[model samples]
Target: MESLIKKLSKSHKDCPECPSPKVVHSFFESILGLLFPDFATELLKEEDQISEKIEELRHKLSRILIRNKHLHDGDGAEIAHLFFLKLENVYDLLIQDVQAMYDGDPAAKSLTEIIRCYPGFYAVAAYRIAHLLHSLGVNLIPRMITEYAHSKTGVDIHPAAKIGERFCIDHGTGVVIGETTEIGNCVKIYQGVTLGALSIEKADADKKRHPTIEDYVVIYAGATILGGDTIIGHHSIIGGNVWLTKSVPAKSKIYYQAKMYNPASDETDTYIIKSEG
Candidate 1:
């Protein structure tokens, strides 16, 4: 007991205290509620009340950043101010994402439903918020925020991944978007999709390790695209269970052909590619 206590004491002293999970979650929920009323408990009756709420959230963020100043380079208060200034653009992008999800999914009856119930919206919302903090040079908190969403939604999107506007993730369970993955506009990915890397070498950590999906690409459920150099061109349809590690040109359709499902069969399947006329 003495040895264990002595060992933990030094490491505990060395490690700086970070913002508590409750505090971080509160900040996220407060900001989200302010943006979308579907998530808010009560609506602000006046413009002044709304303005006060914004300032309060800003102060909350300032405190969070100030608490973990060791993770990033800059003043926490200044970063908080700048983050709010550019937050309107993020809100606009989120609106576009919600619209895209509604238009893409036939089952979706209204925008309110998607905003209130969809796991994709929750995951994407976390990602966008984290991405903005990441851009402001804040590090650990962004990751913490995304991981919280991942825990709830089963969608693992890294804080650093570059995702374009109007992105839609339908039935988003078991979806993994890696750190270096780059996705373009109007791209839709279904459940069990893994946009991953071929290698896990620590030496290649600084290099690009994930594939790029171009505009208007639809990646269906259970598709796995890997390797840094692999690029799926615009207007491509990647079928369910299709795995690709090489670049495909624009307007291509890729799918795997299997005669029948056999749990007992240990057979290898090949994917067929078709280019649009």
Candidate 2:
């Protein structure tokens, strides 16, 4: 083992700390097993088997990061290992998403269905994992994970966002939840939605760039709510494709103008009209 470590150290001249990730991950798993004795058996039934799986996953992640230029020579593997050590949080996040899936929809037949079928769960799970890495201060890997999920699920959640529990997203395609955004519990968003910044210009850097969404708000498909200081009040329902830049009262329902196509002629145009209700 010593000779093998020396060989690897020589081979990875730029990253001397590569081997630390495995050790760090192992320590983390062991500590978790120690803390939760009730679930220890299930968590570590075949210790060798689970360790092998973790090592396999770590290698895959490391290779991907290295190949993609996400991991660098000077980047300490210990930093990443520390992040992986908090795997329990990842499990907790999964439970939250699964429970939300089971309770949020009657159509969800089983936990297996929630795990297998829901794109929302997938996105949220990715986000939770990414958020953990982000919190641990591993720069590129978290973004890479979330970006991978974005590509697969069409839900683009920035890893830097602070998300609370019981969050459920439905049909979550084309969703852009921005960095610096904070989402409270029981928030639901649909496809083609953007909870993003009002400005990306240099003047807006220190300012509020994205909206703060309170609890129980449902942002329907195709809505674009922007600005950092903008708050969508608790229990508000934002209509689809609506462009919002200001705060709304709790329980407020904002309806957006719908587009009508003229099939008669080649010329195309659109208009916006407020609702009477």
Candidate 3:
């Protein structure tokens, strides 16, 4: 046991370049606080204090870049400034997402409820922020932020995914949006949905692997759509538990026809349980 401990301690000492997870998490929290000041406290209610909050955000981001030595190749202050320049745009997108959730789900009571409690909203907000960092060519930090969101929300959205405006993720748990997945505006997806690739070959890493979901598409829970060429066309409805590998045309409704069994007659029956077009 002593020898094992010594070896483990040696391994830890050797890897001094590893980024601290605690610092990453703290940075993410700071970003969230800046974005939604009402999230943690009522301290941001006054309109006059907005500039102070922005400066605080800028300082925190600068500190984060300094702490993570491997990700400090460029001007940290400049990057922070650039990020804040698009802060209003990010907030606008988040508002649209919240509105999408409220409009799509009949169970949603108010925008306030969705903003305060919805895990999907939380995940989407994190994704938008992380995606901005990714687009700006900032390394490591984007993945860290998104992974933190995934850990909290069970929604695994790769920072590289291209998702459009008003995208709604209902229930969100077990939802996986791959790196190359492209989702269009007003698309709504439920829990246990995988917009994933059919293959995970190392050679296919640079290629488009995940499916494309066009505008106004609704993918129900447990639907798995795979392959790069697979596209769910505009205004389509994908039913629950359906596995799709090929492309579907616009205005299409795809569903699985389940078989029903009865014990009394020793006979099997097949029926279309759900349908919508």
Candidate 3 residue pairs that clash:
none
Cα lDDT over the full model 1: 0.91
Mark the regions of model 3 whose C-alpha exceeds 4 Å error after superposition.
1-18, 260-277
Query: Distance from true position, residue 3, model 2, in Å?
Result: 43
Best by TM-score: 1
Model 1: colliding residue pairs: none
Compared with the true structure, all predictions reach lDDT values of 0.91, 0.73, 0.87
In model 1, which regions exceed 4 Å deviation? 259-277
Instruction: Tell me the deviation in Å of residue 248 in model 3.
Output: 0.9
What's the residue-level lDDT of 267 in candidate 2? 43
Instruction: Give the alpha carbon lDDT tens digit for every residue of 1-277 in model 1.
Output: 9999999998787776777788788788887898898888789879999999999999989988887889789999999999999899889999999999999999999999999989999999999998999999998888888899999999999999999999999989999999999999999999999999999999999999999999999999999999999999999999998889999999888887756545688655544554452
Worst 10 residues of 2 by lDDT: 31-40
Stretches off by above 4 angstroms in model 2 are 1-48, 55-77, 257-277
TM-score of each: 0.93, 0.70, 0.87
Sort order, TM-score high to low? 1, 3, 2
Residue 228 lDDT in model 3? 98
Residue 83 C-alpha lDDT in model 2? 55
| lDDT per residue (tens digit) for residues 1-277 in model 2 | 9999999878888765443534434433343343333324455557796777566555644544444343444344454465557877777766776788688778888877876678887788778877876786666666766777787789999989988878888877788999989899888788898989978898877666899999988888898999988998888888888888888878888886656677877546564634332
